[model samples]
Target: MTAFTRGFRLHLADGQVLDGAEFPSGRAALVDDPEFGFVTGAVSVEELLLGYHGARIEWDDEALLEGKPRPTADSITSDQLDALLLKAARADSTWATALREAATVADGGRENDCGCGGCDTCAQHRIGLELRRRADERDGGRP
Candidate 1:
């Protein structure tokens, strides 16, 4: 187990501990549960994390294992970056487009994911998606 797996942890930025009624580590796993699929589609991870931290877990859910706490904002940022990368590796152009658009908007005198502060990888994801989209369009709608 990594150091993070031992127990409670905090994100480096704000040092908020997601443990002991403050927040829970199982949020990620819970988010994947089919029972909450409807809510998952409607809410973003950031929003869900903020809104549901410390929220009670229904005891009946077998996947609801109380694990570690939430990490810090910095840790979240890192995770977000990783998520972006994973999305890219999986060829998820929607996220790629969104991230690139975010970067472009940030560069073009618009507010970005103020919380995320934009990233080069996001820009790259956007560019890749755009290129692919254009290629598909040029090929008469076949990727």
Candidate 2:
């Protein structure tokens, strides 16, 4: 039970909710739910609207169980940076070559009990798949 400096109840798009928090104590377990996987840092409503990770955030209100809420970040996260890299891969000169050599293979949609597009498995999962695709290409189809 690490003391969290801030907390929030995340309302997913499909009626599921995930509660989380940041540990200024440097050891908050609340933010890393086994069900929701791992969520680090703070995100604002504006950034959530971008669907950058395929999930919308409830920005109208917040549920802090401990500390004050911080505003949206002034910079992008490393995951966001990776997403940008993947996006850039789309426009790269070798895209056509890579596509022919290693075209995408869909995972047949969500492979979970809740596939309504709200759970971390559904929302954050897309980012993982996309990143994996990028990785496969970068690794010359080794994966």
Candidate 3:
């Protein structure tokens, strides 16, 4: 377990804050409250880093000393880059069409060879669905 000299707060995306959370040996954070003692379960740092499950971590400067450094744009994986581009494409029709066309070509024009709607093999379909979902959200949940 790595203890910080100056502890930091974990500002969660939902507005909940975990004070004095330390980084355990694993890829999780440990919270030891004075009144409640050690908190129940471990908080997955990976989930927070990846912005998964509507949870994202905003690391303060002190937190950087205890755990991994903040992820910059250059550190993100190719898949993450693609997701960001696709997300941006949602706001522009021309970009969205171009991205969809590119994905179709990249996938060899295949719709669903394995019939699994969301597998790595079906890039075009996945991009299409993601774009559609974003559009729906922009349209106030309308399909």
Tens digit of per-residue lDDT, candidate 2, span 27-141? 3222335565876443443443344344544422233211323433554367655755676665553654453333233334343333555655564455446655675666567
Residues 33-122, model 3: lDDT tens digits: 546766533455554345434544544642322355434545757765575567555656555455556655645555455356656646
Prediction 2 TM-score vs. true: 0.23
- TM-score of the candidate numbered 3? 0.26
Q: How high is the lDDT of residue 5 in model 1?
A: 21
Clash count, one per candidate: 3, 0, 0
TM-score of each: 0.17, 0.23, 0.26
In model 1, which residue pairs have backbone atoms overlapping below 3 Å? 10-72, 11-71, 11-72
Instruction: Itemize residue pairs with steric clashes in candidate 3.
Output: none
Candidates 1 and 2 compared: the better one by lDDT is 2
Clashing pairs in 2: none
Ranking by lDDT: 3, 2, 1
Q: Which stretches of candidate 3 lie over 4 Å from their true place?
A: 1-8, 20-24, 32-35, 41-44, 47-52, 62-143
